[model samples]
Target: MSLVRISHYLALCGVASRRQASRLIDSGRVTINQQLATHTERVDSLQNLDICVDGVAVLAPQDKQYWLYHKPIGIDCRLLISDPSSLIHLLPQTPRLYPAGRLDKDSRGLLLLTNDGELTQALMHPDFYHTKTYVVQVDKPLTPAFLTQMAQGVTYQGAQTRPCCIRSLSGFDEGDTFEIVLTQGLNRQIRRMCQALGYKVIDLLRTKLMDVELGCLPENTMRPVSAAELLSLTQLSELTSLS
Candidate 1:
């Protein structure tokens, strides 16, 4: 590859956006050829520059990159500048990248982080209908009729939600909680779904996206995605074709 700005190189490295990489450059975290990079510096990968995150630099790759972040309640899914007190600020290597999709402030769970712009766009496009699963708690008891309406779909803000798969894990006289999966993401979808059914939302949490599940992951923790997950998401993307 020809030499280019470090920010541009970072964007192509699949670690983050050009805008974000600039932040790293300003923070003095990104290095070029084993040297700490000053803002506006440029280099070429074939020239053998070592890009580091934190203090440990990485060997940048052309392969697509992915990361899994367990967002805690109150954490905004949108990327932010490093604040010593912020949740994602603890990232060993900070980069500029945005969330694949949004999660409401009150809700929390798995969220995907990626640097591939085309892949991010394809996965979030409305026509692709990427499936998202969430666990929702309601103030009212689960009724057979309620489940049916949600399954059949309901209108929110004048637009109707696509029919979704709803499973009632339990329903007591006091309240009901269910797991619902939907392909479309409308703002406050789970909450809106309950309100449409004449129910009030108590809590909502996303536990899975496509094949990636939160499992026993603790909140605020993050790690590099496994090779298997990378393969699965790629395969799923191919199957859906994002067409």
Candidate 2:
């Protein structure tokens, strides 16, 4: 049987994350064959091995965890604090993981959390150029001229933005809410783009990224990304990376 890193085994078994499993091993909480483990321990997932956590036998590894978190406004996605009320503080105990990209504290919606470095890298890589969708409520009822200009992507805060897809939302009260898809994500990108067009943002929420839709998942809740979605993302990423 091919042996894999024990950490990977831990991740598959749902014991913790690869990173956290390392820490647990270092802290003398993880044991293999009834002996304390080191970070270098090798484990064959299909082989006979005795694993324990804090003296309790570790059950067989489960599938890897990948989740989408519907972040609310005013909470940072990268922090973990004790206050459950704080948006940053509401995370499950697992391996060390961070959000794949930036969504300002003022913005709310789809945020990806994963321990898979390869997947995160694929999403963040500039070459991937994956499309991200946003539902933005701006100050004014959008005009044709303004929307046309936005489609061309005017330069703002330096470099010109790549051409984007825009569709106006009708029947919304007050300002217009639009569906916009962007490839390049500069800092405060949508907000800055709106400002450049003399529009003020009332609410901003990410609707989708690549094949991963924010879905109907409740606020501040998370769920694993589906296999089909993951395959699509990975395929797109690989194509771009190879090109």
Query: Pick by TM-score: which candidate is best?
Result: 1
lDDT of 2: 0.76
Best by lDDT: 2
lDDT of 2 by residue, 137-170 (tens): 8878888877888889977867788889998887
Q: Report how far off residue 41 is in candidate 2 (Å).
A: 21
Deviation in angstroms for 134 in model 1? 1.0
Cα RMSDs, all models = 6.7, 6.8
TM-score of 1: 0.70
